[model samples]
Target: MRSKVLITGSSGKLGKRVLEFNEGLSFLSPSSKDLDITSETSVNKFLNQNSFNTIIHCAALARMMECEENPNKAFLINTQGTLNLVNKVRDIEKSCKTNIRFIYISTDGVYPCINGNYDEDSPTIPYNIYGWSKLGGETTVRSLENFCIIRTRFFDPLNIPFSESADDIITSSIEIDRLAKIINFLVKDEFNGVLNVGNEATTEFLRYISHKPNLKKCKRSDITKNLNFEIAKNASMNISLMKKILSS
Candidate 1:
């Protein structure tokens, strides 16, 4: 039987793109309707039924506006939901003696550095509820010994139009295909820890949106002389760790 790699939040934009990477692998993607990750019973029951060697946690409450508007809902899905999955994985790994690689997709939003690049060692001081919830999920993933958490920034998804933002934040942005390729590589490698994954170079949010050459770009500084968002000015990760894996 082919080893199964299960992806949560398969209905989301990034998860859908990951399915199309065609990297000679088998993946099981469960839509939110099929898998209610927020429910502990649902998650545990599903994992029990399916045998998987890897779990890619892509499910998250991603809307910044919604998080700000209804923080309770965000906490339910982003924090507690993640805990449900992580705890289940830990129990299975302990009992079965099978190495299960758990990869949590994190965001650079957790870093509060307003004007500098952040690495794996950077202090995380999430400035908003959304970032805090994601960090909370990260803590759950970190507690597992056989897991790898990836702190990823904005990467343009395939076939989706990029949204424009004027913040001078620098992050390693890659195509969705590139990210999927890296994920495939991770499954075969012996890496078992936290790592940062992204493109070879750091790019600004404005440049990422403008890459298509058709979308209108707005300067964030012009609209909000005092920026309203609590995003880091430049919390890009150095993709050296990812590069080493890709080169090998």
Candidate 2:
């Protein structure tokens, strides 16, 4: 039988891409309006109605400024909301008596890199409520034995030109399409446990923005560092794990 994969936040950028790539596969993609992940009852009802072998959690309050301004909402959705789903999954799985793969989409913001690159084991210092909330969700997912927590760092394709800002710290990023492909691998249990995925090089925001000739340049100094805590001058990731996967 084909695997039934359920993806939350199907309306978002990454989720949309994942659905498009796996259009042929058995997928249950639902938007936030269709499913309230923050509500236990809603999650339970949805889980009960659907027989899914895999659940890809892509739902969360992710905008940095928004999360900072509304910390409560962030916690409710990113942290507690994730717990509700995990708990419901555990409960539903008992009667179903089938193994379910729980895939969590996490961010690289959890790491506090004010001066350098971060590895899988690097000390994580979430500089803002958004990061903290995501970390909280990650902790909840870790408690599950049959789960894959993937930490990704990338800016979605804005379609606009990348602006050059010298103060902008360089970080490893993956194109949305590329990241979707990697997630596809995980759906098949290809990798697990705190895997880091991104580009090998740490590219600056300005460099990326410059790729678009039509984009107007914004002064690096004009860009305000928007985080509660300080990070490394060069906070990037080591993509050896991703390299091994591609090679195999």
Candidate 3:
């Protein structure tokens, strides 16, 4: 039988790319107006009315500085919002007597930036409120029976918003379109648990230089020194686990 898929945050950067790449697949991409993950009544109503075997949850308040400014708002939307979805999914599965595959788009920010090359088994120590809130969501997803928590870093190659790229900061960041393709593959596979998805480790400047030739180079300290919250210098992840799964 064809899988029934529901993608939340479809209007987001990565979510938009996911929809563009998977044009052949039939997916229910609901706007925020149609479904709000933070609202239990809204999520329950949407789930009850629709029959989706898989849910790709990409909804979150993802701005780092914004999250730091208002931690309460971050938790309410990123952490509690995820719990709302999980609860409704649990209820739906119990009532329908069927399994639901949950695909959660997490971040590499969950790891301490001091140490790079993190794997799925690495200890999670978030440096900022954004990371902490996402980690909270991950914890709830981990408790679910059938779920895939993807810790990845991706940016749009064509539309990088930054005028200057950080030369000091490093990460295993992949192009948004590539990341979307990998996610598409994973959603159809029988994989569960956490996976770090990204390309080989590289500096932010090098990653964006090709796309933004005139992009100025700046140090991480230069940017973070003005900010109140701490920033991770090295948040690169080991993508061997993701490679193995995709290869197999």
Candidate 4:
């Protein structure tokens, strides 16, 4: 039997790409109105009406400055919302006698960013509120028996949103379409635990130069001065595990 998949935050950028790449699968892409992860009642109601063997949770309050401005909202949506989903999923799994595979779309921001090439075993000390909230969600996801936490950095290749790129700050960022394809492959395999998914480490400026030639080069300090929250200087991840899994 084909696995029934439920994808939250289907309207977002990454979610939309995941949907596009995961074609021909039995997917339920519910809008926020149809299923709100923040509300336990909403999650329960949706789960009761629909049965899915897999869930790809993509909903999160991701902006660093916004999270700093309203920590309460960030916690409510990213942390509490994740808890509600996990709790309800656990209940549904128990009652239905089925194992639900949870795929959590986490971030590389969980690390302190003091150094790059962070692996799955790296120490998690978030530099900002956004990272803290995501780390909180990671905690809940870790408690689950059958779950995969993917910590990745991805951006749209066609749409480079920024006019300037930081030359000093580096990341192991992959194009969103490529990342989505990898995610589709992983979700079907018998892989459970945290996986770091991205490309070779590169500076923000070099990464965007090809796509946006007119983009101005700037240092981390230039960008950080305008923002109230702290940002990672080097958020690159070690993708050896991801490569090994994909190869096997």
- Please write out the lDDT profile of model 4 over residues 1-248, one tens digit for every residue: 57678999999999999999875567999999999989999999998999889999999998778899999999999999999999988998888888999999999999888799999999999998888999999999888889999999898878999899999999999999998998788778899999999999999999989998899999999998998888889999999999999999
Off by over 4 Å in 1: 157-167, 200-206, 222-228
Return the lDDT, model 1, position 238: 69
What C-alpha lDDT, on a 0 to 100 scale, does residue 107 get in candidate 1?
78
Per-model C-alpha lDDT, please? 0.75, 0.78, 0.90, 0.91
Question: lDDT tens string, model 3, 83-169?
Answer: 999998888888889899999999999999787999999999998999999999998888789999999989888888989879889
Question: What are the per-residue Cα lDDT tens digits for candidate 2 across 85-125?
Answer: 88987887677777788999998888875655577888888
Work out how many backbone clashes candidate 3 has. Answer: 0
Per-residue alpha-carbon lDDT of candidate 1 for residues 1-248, written as tens digits (9 for 90 to 100): 34478899888877876677736557888778767889888898888888888888999999877887789998899999999999899889888987777888887777774655567778889888889999999999889877777777655643435445554556566666677667667766778877888764444544565455555555546545654555555666667777776677
Which prediction has the highest lDDT against the true structure? 4
For model 1, the run of ten residues with the poorest summed lDDT: 154-163
Better of 1 and 3 by lDDT: 3
> Whole-model lDDT for model 1 versus the true structure?
0.75
Clashing pairs in 3: none
Reference-based TM-score, model 2: 0.89
